[model samples]
Target: MPPYFYKKRKRGAVSMNYSQAVNWIHSRLKFGIKPGLERMEWLMNQLGRPHTNILVVHIAGTNGKGSTLSFMRSILQEAGYSVGTFTSPYIETFNERISMNGIPVSDSEIAQLAAVMRPLVEKMEEELEESPTEFEVITAMAFYYFGSVNKPDVLLLETGLGGRLDSTNIAEPAVSVITNVGYDHMNILGDTISEIAAEKAGIIKKGIPVVTAAENREALTVIRQFAAKQQAPLYELGNHFSAAAKSRGEYGEIFDYAAPSLQLTSLMTNMKGRHQVKNAALAIAALEVLPLSLSEKEIREGIRQSSWSGRFEEIISTPKVIVDGAHNTEGINSLIDTVQRYYGDKIVHMIFSALKDKPYQEMISLLSEASDSITFTSFDFPRAETAENLFKAAKVQHKSFEEDWKKLLLQKMETMREDDVLIVTGSLYFISEVRNYCRKNFLEK
Candidate 1:
């Protein structure tokens, strides 16, 4: 028997077993070319639109959406509302994409849900004569699960690639948030900032309120036009709300935020980097636009307690192994700025890799300015740039390159004294390999 068949037999004669369901998804799920609202509408219509009962918050942007969603989820949960959050391109596992009340769905629950939905999805595929994408299936599963078990008071839905065609746009959101716009997914969205902003602006529904961070003039114009056409209330960060850093040090950043209805001062965030402060501000602004009443004390407490891992995350502090998922130009600039601001004039050893589609050359060119040495590595993905490719790129910039990242990293750690920083970045996928290497070699307990 085949591997999947063998596994199914081992699990006993269940028609749609866990392994089988996973296999089915793997076989059917594909990326690219599928766009528009028709597929999601059809799926939801088939399922009776369970999202109508759930209070939804739609977040879209080229960057910072995930971190902002994290901040919002923490605050809402702290304020005693049951919350379900869905984010894409998970750092570790597929199950990480869906969370209920800030906890990931149980593996058995995911398996059971996949098993139940597999047949229905397949039937839909045949009946409609068009197969649903991987994202659509998982989205449907998340909506159904959130409705059945958590029935959350609020749901934070982050757009996958772009907003107009993203599966998460199906929800009639109570509030829509645009973190900021930048150049990414140009192949699908568009090449220009205005075109991309128009795609993201699709999440702005009629008569709904939108909270947006400060954006460039071009992107803001597109968003403003959309809001005007839809008659959605727009709250721009600097105009309608603002946050200023009260104090920042090695501990973390503390900022004061003035929202429409609430003023929170000295709100300390555990997340590192100055850009995180901006993400917090956007989350606070979103909360301000909501009808739910929250005291200043509650807002302060929520801001102080919000945590989002993998954004400038420090895994090991001894040799100072920092991992950040700064794959784009804007994010890379933020990471470089943060490192300089915190650890000034210090030499940084960088371990880097990126997806084939990303602006890897641009990212590397910027990073080369701050990095002391570069170690090229490959991540476990089909589209990941090979270590050899990265090494060649580093050579053009006259930077030192180590092709065997594992061996080279161990060598560096053994030779370097304290005070030197080691940064593992470029892609979140590579961070896992770096972490595993550290755990086996250096980290104890």
Candidate 2:
């Protein structure tokens, strides 16, 4: 029998099947973001400190962390190494959060793991007088699953929040990566760039190699100071490693990568946007600093195969529909720039939505340049801002509101010309829902 068997409810904690397990885990979101590693450390201890057993490549940043991780995971896999990855917010499914060799953990596997861990979690709650945050619990599960059942050659961990107190930070990484810090989550991670950089820098473990693409003077200063204090070798993006776009267009981009140890010309990546070149460079630099040796062919092939959905992901061809997760100002600005670079002359129709707490107004303003007409829509998420509120906040000349995204999309698709394009962007949560709707309603048929 599995360790998860023979579980019974104690003090209202009930044993759950797959769907029920997901719901129960998500219910802990009400505990909110607690910025400390004490609970994570305690939880790890209870789980036999599984994190210590696995080699980690820990990544933290405001944006690009997901894309960078994708690149690294691909590269590692291409090198014939088994890899485990932990990412956040699950673009499409909950199972995606924990993956072994790029395959998501099955629903039954998650359910069984949740059942086995429920009693220990309840014990912690009883002792601490509070439940762990949803992210913390998921982090614990990833560590346990990767450490025990699906032990891999390496684990790629992306921080759920600021690095210092983030649950993922409990693991000691062979290489620590900060993929350019910026303002997003200001309420949780301070207002200034330096302050946010400091939070990201917290993942720089003592004597570990630190790789970063942080370009801001103030932010770079903070990272440099932290790395120096920790005596960690620092690899700055522009200084130690860099990528220059050779050619970029609708299909994909080719870039030249230059670094201290190696240089590759015309490295190809199907990933859209010039910013992705930088992200790929960061991933390459990270791999370079790691103890392992990999061939340039493996690196190139990995980058070519690396694709992160919803980051300028094109869903359709004629009157092309592109979906991107550009929720914050920084990401929105990047999206705008990438669109301008590729589809500047084309008239763009945009479907946008955002969470209430984000700087959606600024995001809207930035997105306006890439869009000729914009429709503000809201998803079913509790924290989603209403379409009317987003419309009012945007105050764009050619703007409208639609409460239902599918209806809005269908309505717009009818009028879009062959030369025109439709872009769906904003919150990752919103994009995920809208993408699913498109698959079922538009793509599948």
Candidate 3:
């Protein structure tokens, strides 16, 4: 062997610095989306199976998963338990993906954990003859950090993609939650609702309880088949439990949630939209199944306190700038419902962007119905579709394209009246960037 290669081998897999560790993990992006449990299983074994030690509530869905997880985390924390949450496509920073007690993991802690896992990861790669993907490594990081170091009482694990082969599926969660089945990730997940539901239902473990808010017949059938096959008791929405919105206004929606063992009247969720009622109810249902001692007062207080940023997040009062990460059809429809319910006939200006892989046209069409004016814009991401492409796909007449999204948004907002609304949405990646800018430029002031 050459001297350089021999020296590299001699150095061995040592712990890396923070920047080095992040870069090394990002470098695995080239490995792409290799979905399977084999790599994660191998990695966990090398890490002494830290995931096996933590109590997890595994959540999967096309939308509402993050919100549901947040609601549950808040409730759990209110019940006096330390909670760890693992979510994807973070709104602000990478560290936000792995959080303990609603606070993101510190940078130094992430670096330290990365260093510890580096050698083991390398050994696994060498043995498996293939490196793990970026998500797989991050999943392992969450499992190790939460299970070993942070030691939370419960971990809320959200699936990154399809549930069946997702890296996060390695855990045997106490309960599996599918918030709802929707048409997203068609390229990898599938083409139809049933196909997608089957993939999301993959999280259902044998003898474990499964909870879902999915209403579609096709989707429900798949979930039913899977739960029956796995012998997992299924608690479904609109049947096992239900939430009805009594009143909704600018403040928030008041709803009544009822399950067999628990009932709460006039529960309020800070998260706007009727869909949020269902999300909160699913959180309650999952909490009900767990053998934890919780009170109705704590659950109500927790749901009120729990808030997920970038989902109908109102940033400014005047001109009423709201940002929602409605990337898929179901989410966009929910956005439309909220907009119509709250804003009424007010003039609405929409700023939209989506990934090339998403069904932007369908989403644009649905959004157009709710907005008076639409501006198709692009974000600074590799997968972001250009403004021109989105505009060409748009069928709405009151639509324009703007490549310089920041300048366009600012210029447009300055021209808005008091009652007019500026709704920024489409892709979560796009929403994250715009939301950060809006907070610094608008909210901080």
Candidate 4:
């Protein structure tokens, strides 16, 4: 342990209720996405390096990280192993970021964890003259919870941003999984696929196995080089392991998976889109490479049980409403493919809202291909693009803007014909809001 890891801070425990704790954490958003690990390293050190004792499956990628993590978590749970997962950009509640057996950290646990972090964060600010970002703070909480509070058999750690500099990168993982690399965080990661791939490959460690579904040649080459440099075994999706689609089943995507150790047919994911199949395949490959032995039954049952919300998630049945978290161009492309394949015959109405930082123009352009009728709408977030600004990105025949997403959703839902499908796309945050509204007003009723 580093000498500073034992920084004897003369401080009292910061007390807080649930709301106060959450608000305090949210207030750190002003620090923004400062992409570096100096703060995390310092904070973890002060916390006595709680992350070292835990076994982690460090997952990094632009998009599929959450879905892949869910697959692994489900399978491990099915195999009767306790699994803890740390993921970002929660689809529902803030406590969902740190979970065990798919159950979110409790409100009391969240408050307690926040209390543990408050003092350390204050100490870091005083010593380093810098505040940790919201993500960094949460990563610390996960480490503390899983490390000191309750130690699970394994932890699925998802990088909040780029792998190398993300707050969650301190973990010494048993296996490193990169779902895929793409151009999402260009400003922080880099402008090119190679740069981004290298950033994602930062989780690679000596002798650790790497599993990736990255198909882009440039991205794959960068990943291969990083794996070689680290002397880690590389498992490419289409090369070392592969998932071939059999059909889009009633529940989700059905496919056949093949890897060096095992091969299985009719492996199904309970999430829509072909990309989900790749995620499930990556999950299987990642688990196979882990130190534990997972049976074929566990793998199949686990993948079949796993479902990620806000990714091609269908919220309503009649006059079907689909909510997808396709904030970037690559994700938008996948959404477009799913739409064309499933709702091709229906008259699709697309609602989109994204953060200003995302490639909303390209995303809007791609949504146009999936549905000519497009409506741009904004949500209650700092980075959310204004509905009018999002409207400017669309070049479709039927395009409009609505400042009130609820009003638009209600108007569209009430007026949808029998052959119409309503899709709410764009930012995960926006979709999260939409999902909550639907659950309260429609699904619950």
Off by over 4 Å in 2: 1-15
lDDT of 4 by residue, 1-445 (tens): 1222223333667768899999999999988888888888888887889899898999999888889998999999999999999988898899999998889988877877888789888877887799898989999989978887778999999998889988888899999999998899898899999999999999899899898999999999999999999999998999988999999888799899988779999988899889899999999999988789789999999999998888898988887899999989999999999988787888999998999999888788888888959998999998888999888777667899999999999999888998899999988999999998888888532
Put down candidate 3 lDDT per residue, 233-298, tens digits, no spaces. Answer: 999999999999999855778999998888889998888999999999999999999878998889
Stronger candidate by lDDT (3 vs 4): 3
Candidate 4 lDDT (Cα, 0 to 1): 0.88
lDDT of 2 by residue, 1-445 (tens): 1343223323434456899889878888899888888888888887788899998999999899999999999999999998899998898899999999889988888886787567778888788876788898899889988886668999999999999889898899999999988889999899999899999999998999999998889999999999999999999988988889988854678999998779999888888888899999999999888778799899999999999978999877765888999988889888998888888999988999999999998889888887899999998999999999999998678999999988898888889998998999999999988777777766532
TM-score of each: 0.92, 0.96, 0.96, 0.96
The top-ranked prediction according to lDDT is 3
Higher-scoring candidate on TM-score, 1 or 4: 4
**Candidate 1, residue 242: lDDT:** 89
**Candidate 4 stretches greater than 4 Å from native:** 1-11
Q: Show the lowest summed lDDT stretch of 10 residues, model 3.
A: 1-10
Error of 3 at 378 (Å): 0.6
Candidate 2: give its CA RMSD in angstroms: 2.4
Worst 10 residues of 4 by lDDT: 1-10
Candidate 1 residue lDDT tens string, 73-167 = 87887788888998876665667788887788766666766764666666677888777788777888777666554577888989887898888
Ordered from best to worst lDDT, the candidate numbers read 3, 4, 2, 1
After aligning candidate 1 to the native by TM-score, how far in Å is the CA of 273 from where it should be? Answer: 1.5
